[model samples]
Target chain A: MTAATASAARADDPLAIDVHGLVKSFDGKVVVDDFSLAIPEGKIFGFLGPNGSGKTTTLRMLCGLLTPDSGEGTCLGLDLRDEAPLIKRQTGYMTQKFSLYEDLTIKENLDFVARLYEMDRRTERVEESLKHLGLYARRDQQTGTLSGGWKQRLALAACTLHEPRLLLLDEPTAGVDPNARREFWDEIHALAETGITVLVSTHYMDEAERCHEIVYLAYGKLLAKGTIANIIDNTALYTWRANGKNADRLASKLRGCDGVEMAVAFGADLHVSGTDEAALEAAIAPYRHEEGIEWFRHKPTLEDVFIHLTAGSKDNFS
Target chain B: MKRPFSITRLSAMLLKEFNHMRRDRTTMGMMVVIPLMQLILFGFAINTDPKALPTAIYSADTSEYTRDFTAALVNTGYFHIVKETRSQEHLDEMLTRGQVQFAIFIPENFTRRLIKGERPQILVEADATDPVATGSAISALNAIKPRVMTRDLKGITMANPPAPPAFDVVVHRRYNPENITQYNIVPGLMGVVLTMTLVMITGLAVTRERERGTMENLLAMPVRPMEVMLGKILPYVLVGYIQATIILMAAAFLFRVPVEGSLTMLSGATILFMIANLGVGFTFSTVAQNQLQAVQMTFFFFLPSVLLSGFMFPFRGMPVWAQAIGEILPLTHFLRIARGILLKGSHFADIQADLLALVAFVIVSTGIAMARYRQTLD
Candidate 1:
């Protein structure tokens, strides 16, 4: 599509990222295959996938960091192919790994980023970003010396300081602690509140739950995309939570039982999930009357649905 | 019960190392190719006794005596008289510009003075900046007298061979009268040092960014490839100047090598040559996948530069093919410009070709580097 049509579509639809039939391959191996996504402006969309499931590839293609093999898309109301430079100018991309210059000081790193974007008030922007990230006190310290959480915070600040209209974060909080991750999510939400769209790839179930919508990809294919409630309802997975003495030990016995798709241990409890509720009940009927065991029908968690979806998908690598 | 040195464990470690080496094909190729290439290049291409030195003949007389004299000089196989000029100024220009290494001036009265039995002087001015290149050729001049006199005056010659032609051969070793090797080597070292360090420093610049994962982030932003290349190269240009300054100072004070040309000209040419080397390094960085490969690529370019650029050996001594290869390297042209300016006091017009070659190197290398630099994570 031309830029005019893309902008017109955006005018009518308010989508920050609207891409379809995007296919990308590396060395003859398809990393993102015929994928389509449309995220409305200001919505926080989470991308969930197994490792090497093409989440990163799809995110990179959306931000113009990579080109799709055969695709047409618009990011921030600009054509993904012809207007990539303009799209890049208005997009912020946070890499999965720590990608800032480790030898440079934190302030220097921010200044470098500011200069790269040719921001008008470079010094003021850098100072403001440092203060906002609570990095002003340690701005002079070299980035390599900082902890993992601090490094991520600095990366986020550097990417967003340009005030991009769209942010593509690829596992931004992969190795960070829970507290730092929560703080990062808060900042993401705050940015979203100001109308900046965020598309973040994550493996954390809780993080996915916080997004307005979630996309689950397996083996370069999008298996599901919707709100958490919609995805849970679509899966139609029946789960039984067993809580009692030796309940966790019953996981292996129930794993290969008839109609039991997955039996996973969550702390002291066992969550047995399946697609067929009657067969699942029949499989667990013998254990229903077992001594010192309590079984209750439970709603399937997001992790259960995702695990089930990924397990059924083919491993493209093999 | 376990032994300190088990054969199984040692074999396992050896096998693992072998696997790693096999996987890194470039390193494996370099491991064998570098030494072999260096051996062939240094062994076959290097010659200290450089022959066929370019000589210009300025004979105002053009008589049979001068012809005999020129023939005798060419017969020695040391001098290759590429240009013949009647103007003494033209001969001087040839030598000053390094178009010719030696200038043979036979005055108009040469044949007359010879027949009159008066000892006439035959002046031969040798560009002795590269002392090794001129040593054997100058020594061969002494043997020419007996052969030329015996061949020219066959009918009237006595058994004494015409008393050595009734002439004195005035050998003027211009620029470096004492034939100091350091005068040539120390100035050439400046080019070599800059080539080695500047190429390595800038070669690692982009590769280091890629290896450390910063290149992805940098490419993701709105930066242009030219901006990235120039940004990586400009810092090293200053570093190159620092290196040049240190070498120049040491060459002046410590080694007592003269800087005969204009210091401003030297600095200007050095800056261009530095940028050329930085461009080469940037190109290597683009081609190399990691810092290690970048270092290897730098060495691959550097070895031939040191060997074929006339830094370690005479330039004219090597074969035409090696010279052709050396001509492509910035170091080769820079060496000529460096030695020409520092030792010979060559003018801008004298080293203009070499300077142009370096500028071309900078432009071409920068273009290649920018072309090779990826703007996407492909």
Candidate 2:
């Protein structure tokens, strides 16, 4: 249980986390239902979902911090049901909010965590954590005075200081700037290189693509999950872009039209999608022939998949 | 128009404060109700007039004279005959069991001795469990003594002697001779008020950050729960100590309250109770999700601590079930220990149980707070 013994990764061991048929409910409402996945060791797995799609709950359940309603899992080679405490000891959770000791200096905050873990040479551990996080220069500064980016860095430093094998980040870069988000992702990738498995939930599409793999959840149900190309290739829908005056108005009118599965505004253009390419073309032929408008065949983006999937999905919790 | 300073900016700041106040109805209610509550607590419940004395009568003779005396004592309303025994053997049992506060025994030659111009001794025993109540009993006896013995034989003085105030009344002020209410409350309020303000003020301090999205960095740190709990509570403990000392000094100098006991013991008790109270604050912080809710929760705890804890009311007078509830409050035992140390000069052994209770409270509260805080960390 010493830090030296705990610091090493258990990579040669079986899956860092493995769960199947994970179901979770709150107040008789199912939040995460029939979820199953296996996260390989030393990979940054990204969880992408529209808000309130049970992403956070699924992550919580997978980490052994929460028990599923009817599913079973193992985290860090220990049965989650019987060894949650042990699993928690080795898992680091970086919450979306800045949840550090504001009144305490950055160095003092790290020292406190080091002491909590009962680590030997707390000062050395704190120094090492700060240096690893590139926060040594601002070590003595009060954590409250730090910006969002620095706060994110400090949070990562603290969780990793105890050298947890797994890190669960709940929208860690939520309000962080693009540069800081990139830096955070870089640190996450670096942690992964050391064989620390990282599971991150995010709202940004760019961040999603940065992960080794992506799992998309809508209304507590996984819609499409794989590499960006694979997910796009699996969908049978074809998209056509329309550029014109009041294309936003056209998108509304195309919804409920035959063969037009989804019509969504993409900036100054409207991207129309349908599983039946002929019917889709036929439905948009009249609108395309109108004045002051031009149409072109377009490739489907992740945004198109998200809008199409979520529009058709029922609000299960509501 | 360009030259004018921005009154709108100052007004916006003031408006922001108003909006905050409007959003937090709990604070608004506290502001409106606290003054009225303080008035009732200090003015009404805190009183020196201890009434309802329980007593026992052991009439061994069962003569007409003994019966009359027993009837007179019962009719006075000051004594409620809690136990009536046929023999003196049960008198000790009654007092020890706390079934009756005092016992009076009229011996065999009661009427016969009085006819021989000899003073008959009417025995009286008082249970001195509570000194304040015992003092009132002794004072009441003192006031009634002359009337009992003289019997108002107007314009009739004996040629030999003016009936030399026929009988004497002996009173024992068991614990406190000069019964002063401040001697008890001043030291206790030092603990109670310091506890009320410090625990509640710091209880929500960290929770506020957590709610406002600032706690992420806190959890990210290398700090442990105990460190965070201590760091948050220690500054407030020091503040409580300083406030307690100031209050105690004020009570002594301004109120002229005497600390008949050891000041060191009182201070020790105060600090111990203050730390226990901080543990309570930690519990509140762990349970409450926001600063407003934390304040509400702390006050919810504080109201009962004031009412049932005997800091404002006498614990002895309450029903046993009610007293059991009071015993659960830290302030109750704290007041008992502080009053015993400050007013009665009781040694450490006398207050060991109170100290143990406070220590247990601190341990349980700290454990609960840590466990709950960890569960909700994410």
Candidate 3:
């Protein structure tokens, strides 16, 4: 993991979380199977996976909330097994749901959290948290009555009150409006700049693109990990577009052909991608001469590679 | 900015809590009304008074003298003759099997002895298991039969010959003195009140945090479970004391129930019981999924605690199997200890077993709760 981080990350701060062969299972079904990763400090790390692919479980194991069945690893330079409470103390976790007490006012919620950590000068701390989250005006409003955006801000403030070193955000902006989500992400980025490492799990393509690096998991296994450009290159996938005239017709013909892992029509254009360059060329050779059809090679987007990779993988649950 | 916690933070939380209480009517009502409602219901409804005690009459011979003696037993009202039998075998069975509270027998020569103006002996047998029940029935018999014997003595001097046969009657009540119901009931009420409010109010503490998502925030902070437990329970302990104080005052004022013993000792014992009960409530919070489930679990605890504690029925009156089941409950020992001290003024030597039992209960339940509670935060 140290080697992986040294070779890959050239950020201002280095890796803060490094783990190897992290494994966990429940009721004989492996939930996180032989996973490993290096997350750079002071940067947003995005974890993306389909539903029930062990994304949450892997995150739990990484944060020391759940123990891996068999693994040797370190988080914040402490042994993962022996130093869970120590890890928990310095780490902040934002669950998927809005969990703050609905009965308490926004100020009260933050104050209670402040006291739990036995923070000094609690009144001033609560004031700053309320003001910093842009919740000063609504400080007296009950948290249950607050809007999604405001509630998210309160949750964020409470989690960060103790100035934790790492924040594990599980779909932090899941239900917020687009503007609020953007604002929330901006604060997260700001926290990262202050040397607080953030590990975020998201499914939105735009959010995935915002991450410094993305790790993709499928069926409890780490399928892909790298920068956006690097992951595309590692898949060895070639993508081509046919738009003019018979694009739809050409898509129908390209389906199920050897070397063409995925082919789909996007409105007037058909995108075709595959791993084998020579076989793809041979398969599309006849179509290149087809009248009124234009073809051009293009750099594969992260979405294109993801669709192709998932299309070729088998469901582990079945 | 202040740190995660300070006196200011706790005060701020407390102030906000007060504000919420003012705005939230249901919570305020719970704080005010539930205690009073429980006080009235438990204080009056739980009693140990036994009514309509049955006694069997056994006559060795059919004679007018024996017949008149049977009539005297019937008028006492404390005992009713369930069966009239000729054989001593049935009398032994009736007494040993607890079918009757008492049995009386007249010898075959009782009338002849009376005719001769010599002493005629009538024997009364009483079950001594429950001292109060036995004592009350004995008092009634002693008061009524002596007057009858004196009248018979006058008749012999006037017409028969010398003096009538002398008769003796004995009265006995079991478990309590003079059949006082308060002796058994006051102790049971203490346990019932502790079970109702302490387990319920504190049960909502952690679930409130979990529901509010503040628990995650707390977990993310440097606070340990021990600190959270202490901070969470300290306030509720105050509430528990308040509840205990109200119940004690009500019991004394409304029911005309005297302390008869040290109030300080009662309060001290109550604090230990509250600590045990609050820990149980904390455990419930960890087990329950939400506020609703927590309340449900509390009532589920309360019903058995009330029924099996021997509050309504004499412990002796219940079948041995039921008695064995009753012994497992905290209320059983709590009632015993409360009764022993308040009514009997029992010293530590007399109620030591009950105190030890309550201590054991506190240890086992709290240990289980602490173990499970830490896991929820973990």
Quote model 1's iRMS: 16.7
lDDT by residue (A1-318, candidate 1, tens digit) is 000112112355599998999999999998898898888898898999899999989988987778899989899889999888888878999999999877677887887777666677878989999999898999988789999999998999989988999999999999899999999999999999999999999999999989988888888888888888878787778999999989999999998899999999998899999989999999999898889989999999999988888887753335
- Give the CAPRI class of candidate 1: incorrect
Q: Could you tell me the fnat of model 1? A: 0.57
For model 2, the stretches where C-alpha displacement exceeds 4 angstroms are A1-14, A128-135, A243-249, A288-294, A315-318, B1-181, B198-202, B205-286, B316-324, B348-378
Per-residue lDDT for B1-378 in model 1, tens only? Answer: 112233332332233223333444674454334433433343345445577999999887877777888888998888999999889999999999999989989888887777666657788999999886888888889768766756676656454344654555666567777555556666777787778777887777678789999888888877677666666666557656766776677678866888889989999999999888888898998889999999999899999999999888778999999999999999999888888888889999999999999989888988888788788887
Chain B TM-score per candidate, please. Answer: 0.57, 0.60, 0.64
- Provide the TM-score of the second chain in candidate 2: 0.60
What total of clashing residue pairs does each candidate reach? 0, 19, 32
lDDT tens digits, residue span A65-171, model 2? 46788888788787767766567668888766676656667887676566555566777888878887788998878788999888888888888887899998999
Query: TM-scores of all models?
Result: 0.75, 0.67, 0.77
Candidate 3, DockQ to 2 decimals? 0.33
lDDT of 2 by residue, B1-378 (tens): 121223332332233223334545685455334433443464346646455578988877766556666666765556788778887879878888888878888888876665444767888888776776666666666556455444422223243222456456655555555555556667777766766776786677667766875554344333345556666666556556667666667667755666778888777777778888888888888778899888898889888888899876778989999899888888988888877876777889999999898888878877787787763233
Q: Please, what are the lDDT tens digits per residue for candidate 3 over residues A90-162? A: 7778877777778778887787777656677989999988888888998888888988888887888888987
Q: Pick the candidate with the highest DockQ.
A: 3
Ten contiguous residues minimizing lDDT sum, candidate 1 chain B: B1-10
Pairs with steric clashes in candidate 1: none
Question: Every prediction's TM-score for the first chain?
Answer: 0.94, 0.89, 0.90
Off by over 4 Å in 3: A1-7, A10-13, A242-257, A264-270, A278-296, A315-318, B1-28, B45-183, B207-217, B284-300, B317-328, B347-350, B375-378
